[model samples]
Target: MSSKQPDTGRLTEPCEGYLVTPPLLEAASFADRLDHALTVLPVAAVRLRLAETSPETMKRTILDIREIMDRHDAALMLDGFPELVRQTGCDGAHVEAEDVAAARKILGDDFQLGAACGFSRDLAMLAGEKGADYVAFGPFGAEPETEGLALLTWWREMMELPVVAAYSPASEMADLPLPEMLHTLAATADFLALGVTQDGHSFDALWQTPEKFLPLFAETAKD
Candidate 1:
């Protein structure tokens, strides 16, 4: 891995969070949840990952979140729906690492294309080489703080493209608190990707519920 640092000549922004919506969504309700999340964290982007839906439904979901995304100035992204990216006027699409090349071709050069590499460096390299704007690393299981954190650190040293520290929908495990992962990867990742909510609790509880953590995240937002 290369030890060279990234080139940031201007005032560098701190690592930003990215929210991934639930696989199944009721546009309006999910939008409300998403709006609440944006208020808590310094989100830079939001991804809509659908399970199986018609084009119209997908478009509506995008339309609902569009307002909040625009309000927060966060880029809007679709998961595995490169074609809809332009159709819905989203900022980008996140595809399997192997599909980066083909997706890039379809979307052309202007739109952002992120790769879902699921903890594989080789896959990440493949996607990055194929013109992916960024690569996401994990929805890690137990022991993520050690294994996952180590991976993000290694990736920061090795790549210049932004890296996202991703979490699975059931991300808030007892031993795995969001803040610990966020705090540990603050210097390494460009975005922290996770579901909008966990169980019945809102996303804010993951970071915002704790009053003490607010100051730390607020400081990051100012940067």
Candidate 2:
């Protein structure tokens, strides 16, 4: 190895955390992806974005996936769809800054609650203090429209709470492989919501599998 230390960026851990994605496809395709995922990786958890697809269809898909895959830990994220989340009987729900209190009240303490806080450290901290199970930030990539790396760095430096950053596969400039991305995430965020965008749309694409997360696991295991 070179005398120089890897740029761990002040992060220290074996790099294992939750991986979440949306199954916004036909029920058959979604079930196939979930089966493949359970077989491949140590999936810490599975998340479904309810609002991306038709609510009725998504509910059916979520239940079916849960029934078919017995190994993977399952959680549901309701992005601006509280009623649907409640009705689906999900393990938990994800809410925006505005809906945190209400979601917490409804979902109660036992349920996992995740909040989205664009680039605000204060919001992230607040989410933690308000009893959020986790906090999410960027769809971290080369989109100038999205929060840049600096914001994520600031949040990491200031907060003790687990931070989740979204990974955008569509960004033209995000050339770093999954291992490199996981290294960066270890240094900055606690969990990563690898956003698999194929046509400039969220969740309207094929779900990338655990093979995608292998580089990250390998890199983190290194000396």
Candidate 3:
């Protein structure tokens, strides 16, 4: 909650949204690749992995991402550790359902803590009760593609927590080709949780979708 720090959290009411490019262990070169995408997108934040190869190696990757965020004025989101969240100066931490209470206790009131709520309204409510800054609603229950839209709608109405809808391309590849997917995705909720598969992580691939979708998203958002 350092007001002095730039607000790099995801762009949502309860939480800020970022286009998180997950960390890659083998692809040390991927940082720049991901950074390039963040540069083009109107991303509020970026989520980078906390590779646990070794303490020293982890530190190096964290530093690299921090430098990228610093240059972009973007916030960093970590799934590695709460300690790393504080140490790396990331804006927030995303924790699984079982870990939410513990993470909340660890992060305290200052940090942004987002939780995975599955597809249950009770789960989302529990996350809110435990002080989650926002709640993500997938990678489970209904499939992450077409069925996910219904789940997001459910979460939005049933739970007060800000919602994120996550989708893996393999599971949702058919939907990706449809312009309505982008339009409905942008219109549906506060944040869109797109998965970065082996192929989709590329700048050409990722940007291709957005280049087509942003204009469509703008038109849809107006209507």
TM-score to native of every candidate shown:
0.80, 0.72, 0.74
Q: Write the per-residue lDDT of candidate 3 for residues 181-206, one digit (tens) a residue.
A: 54455565666655354343422345
When sorted by lDDT, best at the front, the candidate numbers are 1, 3, 2
* Deviating ranges (above 4 Å) for candidate 2: 1-10, 23-26, 51-56, 74-80, 84-87, 143-147, 171-182, 198-209, 219-223
Highest TM-score scorer: 1
Which pairs clash (backbone N, Cα, C closer than 3 Å) in model 3?
9-16, 10-16, 10-17, 11-16, 11-17
| lDDT agreement of model 1 with the native | 0.69
Weakest ten-residue segment in model 1 by summed lDDT: 1-10
lDDT of all the models against the reference?
Answer: 0.69, 0.57, 0.59
**Residue 22: error of model 1 in Å?**
0.5
C-alpha RMSD values across all candidates = 4.7, 6.6, 5.9
Q: What is residue 152's positional error in candidate 3, in angstroms?
A: 1.3
Model number with the top lDDT:
1
Better of 2 and 3 by TM-score: 3
Candidate 3 local Cα displacement, residue 196, angstroms? 1.8
Q: What is the lDDT of candidate 3?
A: 0.59
Model 2, 1-223: lDDT tens per residue? 0011224453554344444555355456566666665456544455565436565776786666557545554344545555555676666677886568888888776667778887777787777778777677866553343245677766655555556776665633333344355457645555556535534444322244456555565544322
